[model samples]
Structures are given as C-alpha cells and as structure tokens.
Target: MANSTALHSNITQVSVDSNKNIESLRMAYLILLVLCFCIFLYFLTIILSVYFTTAHIRENTRYVLFVYMLINDTLYLVLGFFLVVFNIYVINLPVPLCIVLVILSLTSFMATPYYLAVMSLERYVAICYPLRHAQLCTPQRSHAAIAIIWAVGFSPCVADFIALSSSVETKYFSLSGICGRPMLIKTPMQNNMRYITIIFSFTMVGLIIVYTYIRIMLIARKLSSNKSSAFKAGKTVILHAFQLLLCMSAFTSHFTETYLKDYFAFFPITNFLLLMCLPRFLSPFIYGIRDEVLRKYIIKWHSFAITLG
Candidate 1:
C-alpha cells in the first residue's frame, strides 16, 4: 500500500509540473506575439503617415501601389492576429462572423503576391521603357490596377462561398465554431479550388518576376548611361522575388507542421510566426529603406519627430 501511494504521489507531481510548463510556454508565446505586433504596427503607422501627408509620394504610381500594399498587409496582420488569439483561447465565434473574417483574411493573403508582381512589372516598365514610364504608370492607372487586383483576389473567396453554400446545410452558417480556414472549408471542392488557385497564382507571379529580372539585367548591361538605374531596378525586382518566395512558403506551412509536430510540439506557433508574420513584417523595411525617395523622407520625418520628442 505504501509503495502504491508513493507511486501516485510521483505521478501527481509529474502532472503538475507538466501543466506549469505548458502554461509558462503559452504565456511566453502570447508575450512575443504582442511584442511583434506592436512593433510592426508602430512602423506601419510611420510609413503610412509619410505616404498620406506627402503630396509627391501620394501622386507617384510606385508609392501609391506601395501604400496600397501596406494597407492590405495591415488588414491581413490584424485579422491573422485575432484568429491566432481566438484559436489559442479556443473561443467559439458565430459562423457568419467567422466566415466574413476568413474571407477578408484570404483575400488580403492572395493580394500580396499579386501586388508584388504588379510592383515588379512597374519596375520593369520604368527601366525597360524609361521614355514611356511616366505615361504608362500614372496614378489613375495605378488606382485602376488596384481595383483589378481586389477583384482578382476576391474571386476565390466568392467561389469558395458558393461551394460552401452547396455543401453544408443552411444551419451551418448559423452555428458557432472556432474561426479558421479548416473550420469553414469543409468540402473536397473547396480543397481542390484552393490548391489549383495557389499553384496557378504563384507560378504566374514567379514567371513574371523572373522575366522582369532577366530583362532588366540585360538592359542594365547594354546601356552605359542607363546602366545604374537599370541595375538598381534589377536589384529591386530580385528583392520582390525573394519576398514572393517568402509569401509562397506560407502555403507549405501545413506540411511543415505535419512533419515536425512530433519533433517540436510548438511547431504551429513557430510556423505561423516565421512564415505568415515575418514576410509582412519585412515588407516596409524592404521597400521603405531601399527606395531612395521614401528613405529620404522617412529619415527627415524621423529626425523631426525625434527633435520634438
């Protein structure tokens, strides 16, 4: 009897220790999430403020597209953060509300690569056809392009909703559940659509980026007078390609989680932070710091703010 009681005591102690460790890890994850979000939010505010207040920046087609990307990323980040929190807390949300949130999230997610491709094309035009760049890339045209991007991004969401409506009962939309893609996308048709759309979009964007890079590089080598500008544009396109790859990796996150689950129990959190969050987090820095005009204005505004502080 004494031996059995001792064994029970040891088992109880182990269970308590395990619970404490899990709670500690959860707290740490939450702290990191909040910290990263705050930092990104702060930088986004500064960048967007600069774009909004400056007439020249707002008028330029490149800056206009950049600002739109920033806005889209902000939406994605906010939605993603909320969804992560909801999942962490195991909160049940209204099915309709969750569907709306997921739709917006997916739309914003799809828009990123499209925006990057457009931005690369802009650079390509600016360098490959410098004489026509001004006429080709006006603010009005940029705005129209943005509208087209939104339409394209939301196309998948529309199709998915239709499939969902047909596959599930009317009451399904009325029920409450955890808000996530997996929770809502419950049909084989939805899965196939997702895979097909992702593959097509990524492949097309990859081809566009690669084409632009090669053309810009060839142009850079040919003309001595325009060599510097062409080289700079080539480098910019290369960065865009890198960013696109980062965004693409988010699609493979499920595979990463599946393979590494046993080896690293916190792989989901790690994968989310690294794949989804990090790409958006790096955007402002990649474009803002590298673009000479924006970099100059950012520094000036930063200094002025520091003086006032």
Candidate 2:
C-alpha cells in the first residue's frame, strides 16, 4: 500500500511541473507576439499619416514636426522589438552591439517629449499670437528646432557612454534589458547624473506643457466672445494637450519599468508595452483623426462606400 501511494504522488508532481513549464513557455511567446503587433500598429499609423495628409498640410511646419516624430517612433519600435526578442530568447549580443542599441533606444525615448513640448508651444503661439506666428514659426526655424531637439536628446546618452566604467566585470547582459540600455550605474557620480538627467528633461518638459496649456486656456477664454473660431481653437488646444498626456504616460511607464522593478509582476513586458508602444499606437490616431482635412476625406470615403453598397 505504501509503495503504491508513493508512485501516485510522484506522478502528480510530474504533471504539475509539466503544466508550469508549458505555461511559462506560452507566456514567453505571448510577449514577443504582443511586441510585434504593436510594431505593426506603428507602421500603420505612419502610413496613414503619409497617405491621408494633404500636401498643404505636409508643408506646414507643425505637420513636418509631427512627421519627424512618427519616423522617430517607428525607428524606436523596430530597434526596441529586436532587443526584446533577443533578451527573451537569450541570444548573446556583443558589447558594441548592445551599446549601439541602448544609444538608439535612449535617443528615441528622450527626443519624443521635446517634440511634444515644441508642439504645444507651437499651438500656444498660433492661438495666442496669430499675427506674428507666421514670422516666428517659419519652416527654416522649424528645421533648426528639429536639429536642436535631436542634439539635446542624444547629448545625455553620449555623456553616459563616455562615463561608462572601464571595468569588465560590470559589463553584463543583465544590465541591458528589453526596455532600455542598462545605465551601468557603477559609480555614485553616474547614478546621480542619471537622476539629474531624468528630473531635468522630463520634469522641465512636463512643466512647459502644463504652462503652455494653461496660457492657451486663458487666451481662449478671453477670446471666447468670437464664438466660432474660439471654439475651434479651444478644441484644437484640448486635443494637443491630450496628445501630450498620452506621451507623458509613456514616459512615466518607462521610468517605472526601469526604476521600480520590484513592483511590476511580469517585469519588462507590461511596462514595455504600456510605456513604449502605447504612445506610438495612440499618437497618430489622436492627431490623424482630428485633422480637419483628413476628417473630410474620411467622411467622403465612407459616403462613397455606402453608395456603392
């Protein structure tokens, strides 16, 4: 009787272990699948922006800035996806390749918010100072502004890479996860520098967005007596603010994933999707659908389809 009972116990234990292993395997692939789907959505957003946008709209500085943003987001999605797949499959990556990936990922992450802040400022100028907007926001200046955004966005990563420890023991795959290149915070100075960069960049941009919107609201209210145009301007202002909030969510999610590691149950997977891809997926929808000319085209297209049916 004792021998028979032990045999049954061993069989149950083996079954449980098998089930756990299967579940783990399913979860691993599920994350990779999700990342790929997000990348597809990013590509779709870019295509819609390019195809549906009117030539006149494309010529506008604001729209140009947006197109640049979409392009950056696409690059980030592709590069970040590779990193996720590599990390998941435990593919061995050389140190130089790892560093390059980290630089690109960080550049994308940092560049996006600056663009958002600039966008909000553009709206504020257009609504608050309509007469001088044409003079102030010329395409040449916009190009210069974009150049500055890239320069500032990439400066920190360059600084960090220069400061990276020469110690071979500190170099490990454990540092570079799917979400971001490892900070390699080996020294107290490096750790402090990271904190300063995050606080200055994100916090300053957040403040700029908030301040500009507040100013926009005050100006809109003062001009509310105009009724029709004020209503339209107010609506546009609100939409832009919504876009900023969406971008902010991505920023915060990334910080959480990187810093508050213990709190997330599945580690990088949930944080990666919410922080990294969610903005890329949602930004174009918010901007594209709200575009006046694009909306007209969409309505006409829908009417044509219905008539054909």
Candidate 3:
C-alpha cells in the first residue's frame, strides 16, 4: 500500500514538471514572435515615413516598386504572424475565414518574386537604355504594373479556391479547423497546380534576373563612362536573385521541418522566422541603405529623429 501511494505521488510530480516545461516553451515562442513582429514594424514605419514624406521617392518608378514591395511584405508578415499564432495555439477557425487568410497570405507571398523581377527589369532598362528609361518606367506605368502584379499573384489562389469550392461541401466551410494551407489545400489537383505555379513563377523570375544581370555585365564591360553604374546595377540584380532564392526556400520548408523534426522540435518556428520573415526584414536595409539617393534621405531622417529625441 505504501509503495502504491509513493508511485502515485511520483507520477503526479512528473506530470506537473512536464506541464511547466511546456508552458515555458510556449512563453518563449510567444516572446520571440512579438520581438520579430515589433522589429519589422519599427523599420517598416521608419522607411515608409521617409517614402511618404519625400516627394521624389514617392514619384520615382523604382521607389514606387520598392514601396509596393515593402507593403506587400508587410501584409504577408501580418497574415503569417496570425497564422503562426493560430497554429501554435491550435485554434480551430471557421473554414471560410481560414480560406480568406490563406489566400491573402499566399497572394502577398507570391507577389514578392514578381516585384523583384520587375525591379530588376527596371534596373536593366535604366542601364541598357538610359535615354528611354524615363519614358519606359513612368509613374503611371508603375502603378498599372502593380495592379497587374496583384492579378498575377491572385491567380493561383483563385484557382485553388475554385477547386476547393467544387469538391468541398458547404458544410465543411461552416465547420472549423486549424487555419493553414494544408487544411484547405487537400485535393491532389490543388497540390499539382501549386507545384506547377511555383516552379513556373520561380523559373521565369530566375531567368529574368539572370538575363538582366548578364546584360548589365556586358554593358559594364563595354562602357567606360557608365561602367560604375552598370556594375552596381549588376550587383543589385544579383541581390534580387538572392532574394528570390530566399522566397523560394519557403516552399521547401515542409520537407525541411519533416527532416529536422526529430533533431529540433521548434524547427517550424525557426523555419518561419528564417525562411519566411528574414528576407522581408532585410529588404529595407538592402534597398533603403544601399541606394545612394534613398540612403541620403534616410540618414537625414535618422538624424532628425535623434535630434528630436
């Protein structure tokens, strides 16, 4: 009888300890999520303030694309954060709501590479056809391009939604599940379509970046007077390719998490931050600090803020 009581007490202690450990882990993840979100928000606010307050930055086609990229990334991050939170808490959300969130998240996510491609092309035109750059990259054209990008980004999501609507019963939308792409994207057709779209988009963007980089390199070699500008543009196109690669890594994250799950339990969170969030976080610094014109205004704004503080 005494041994039975002792065994019961030991079991209770172990259970309590396990609960404590899980709670601690939950708190740590929560803190990490908040820290990352806050940091991105701070930098985004500063860069956006600079963009909005400066007339030239707002009007310039290149800057306009940069701003759109920033906004698109922000939207992606916000939805991603929410989805991560919901997944962590195992929150069962209405299927319709989850569908909307997933669609928006995916659209914004896909838009990044398209934006990068356009930005590279803009640089290519500026260097290869300097005289006609102004006519080719007008503010109106940039705005129209943004609209087209949105449409392109939404294409895959729309196709997925249509597929879902046809096969899924109305009762399923009324029911709740943990908000995620896997919850909605169940059909084999949806999976195949997703893979094809991703491959095609990445392939196209990669080719565009590669082509621009090569052209810029050729231009840099030929022109002594404009060599410096052409060289810088080539480097920028390379960075865009790097950024596109980072975005593409996100699609492989499922495999990554699966392979690493035994070794690292928090692999998903790490993957989300590194693969999903880090590229976007680096955007402001990559373009804002690297560009001479934007850097000049960013410096002035930083000094002004410091002085005010």
Candidate 4:
C-alpha cells in the first residue's frame, strides 16, 4: 500500500501541466525581481550619495575601489533583473537569443568572483602595511588591476564559448534558454578545473582572514589605531566568503549528480534565485552600515537634497 501511494504521488507530479509549471516559474521570478530591484536601489543609492556629497570625501584610491565595486554591483543587479524578467515572461525564444543572454549572464558571474578576489587582496595590503599602502594602492594601478581582473575573468567564458561552438551535437545539449548546463558527465579535465576554482576561492578567503588577523595583531602591538578598521575588514571578508562558498558548493552539487538521477533535474532559474538574492540584499546593508564615508554621504546627500526642496 505504501509503494502504491508513492507511485501515485510520482505520477501526479509528472502529470502537472506546462502552464501550471510556467505559472510557478513566474511566481519565482516575481520574488527574484523584488530582490533584484532592492539591489538596484542599493547600488543607485550609493552612487547618488557619493556623487552628491563629493565635497565630504575626496577621491582617493580607497574610494576608487569602492566606486569600482559599486559599478560591479550595479551591473550584476541590472543583469539579474533582465535575466529574471526575460526568462519568466518570454519563456521561449529563438535559440540565438539564448546564446546572447547566456553571454551576458556569464559576464556578470565570471567577473564577480575575480572582483571578490581582488577586494580580498586589497584589504590584505591595506591592513598589512599602513605606511607603504599609498604607494602600493594607487588609482592608476587599481584601475589597471581591475582591467586585468576582468580580462582574466573573461577567458573562461571565451574558452567555453569556443568549446560549445566546436563541439558536435552528439556530445551535449544545445543551449535552450538564458542558461544551460552540460548534460553529459564532466570530463576529468573539467572536474579538475572546477576543483582548481574551489581551491583558489578558498585560498582567497584564507588570505583575507590571515591578513585581517595579522593586521589586528599589529594594531594591538603598537596600539596604532582603534580596532574598528580591522573589525570592519574582517566582517566584509567573512560575508563575501560566505556567499562565494555557498555558491561553489551549489555548483559542485549540481554538476556532480551521477547516473541514477537526471543531471538537469533542478530548475536553473530557481537555483540561481535562491543562491543570489540574499547576497544582493546583504551587500548593500554591509556597505551602508560598515563604511563610515558611505554612510555619512548617504545621509548628508539626502538631507541636503530635502532642504533644497
């Protein structure tokens, strides 16, 4: 009787209509849209606040890093907005449309990890040596460094695109939506590369933690400055690491499902929404509360604008 009941439940699930499935997907996207909009507002608030209150804080290399991060946050949020809207509303489009959206989506995701890595290193240096920091971190160099980060970040997307183009139809599933996954089991080479990514991600997080603690110790030994700076750095790195670590685990689990189950059982859109929305919301909160300059600017700009009105 138990076996029969389980079979009935499975049969009911399989018999669900596409329209109902599509409606459920639409609801999911609506929730994601709200999350994306929140990120947009957060990024916009930072940009506006910074621009309006330029008198408060001069543009230094540290500020430049913050601005770069703001730009990336905006790009990520906007891309996410379009991704959720397009996939949910349109549902199906020409196959080429999928390719175009795939490229844009990948452009955001690929670059984000690298930016986190860069920010980790930046914090490491800022905390490690106070005197040499100005020379070590310059706007010209930071911009160039970011450009390099993007270049390296883009290579994987480029290589994978080339691989997709060159592959025969028999090997894998063709791109059907804004995002697609490899249907076949990963090659040994592919798994090796993913493991490398996992390693590098952890290494970046490790450096952030070690340097943060070391900076704390240095500050303690000399009693040079208050503990707040090191505390702020520690919190930021921890948040970023938590997001990236969760994402890495999700990627590994999704791809590593062996032969018994469907490789593509999960909805790509749903998984992405679940993984990303919380980070987007949390990032702006961290920026506003933790960064004194950002916090002051946000308040002052709004106050001044209201007074003018």
Q: Is candidate 1 or candidate 2 better by lDDT?
A: 1
The 10-residue segment of model 2 with minimum total lDDT is 174-183
**Mind giving the per-residue lDDT tens digits that candidate 1 earns over 228-261?**
8889888889999999999999988889877887
lDDT tens digits, residue span 269-306, model 4: 55555565445555556555467767776766667667
After superposition, which runs of candidate 3 have C-alpha atoms over 4 Å from their true positions? Answer: 1-12
lDDT of 1 at 84: 81
Per-candidate TM-scores read 0.96, 0.76, 0.94, 0.70
In angstroms, what RMSD does candidate 3 have relative to the true structure? 1.8
Residue 250's C-alpha lDDT in candidate 4?
48
In order, the Cα lDDT scores of the candidates are 0.89, 0.69, 0.90, 0.60
lDDT of 2 by residue, 96-115 (tens): 66878878887887788888
Candidate 3 local lDDT, 25-94, one digit each (tens): 7678768877977877776777888889888888899999998899999999989988988887788999
Using TM-score, give the best candidate's number.
1
The list of candidate 2 runs beyond 4 A from truth reads 1-53, 165-180, 224-265, 297-309
Query: Cα lDDT of model 3 overall?
Result: 0.90
Point out where model 4 deviates above 4 Å: 1-32, 48-58, 84-90, 93-97, 169-195, 198-202, 205-212, 215-228, 246-270, 304-309
**Which stretches in model 1 have alpha-carbon errors above 4 Å?**
none
Report how far off residue 117 is in candidate 4 (Å): 2.9
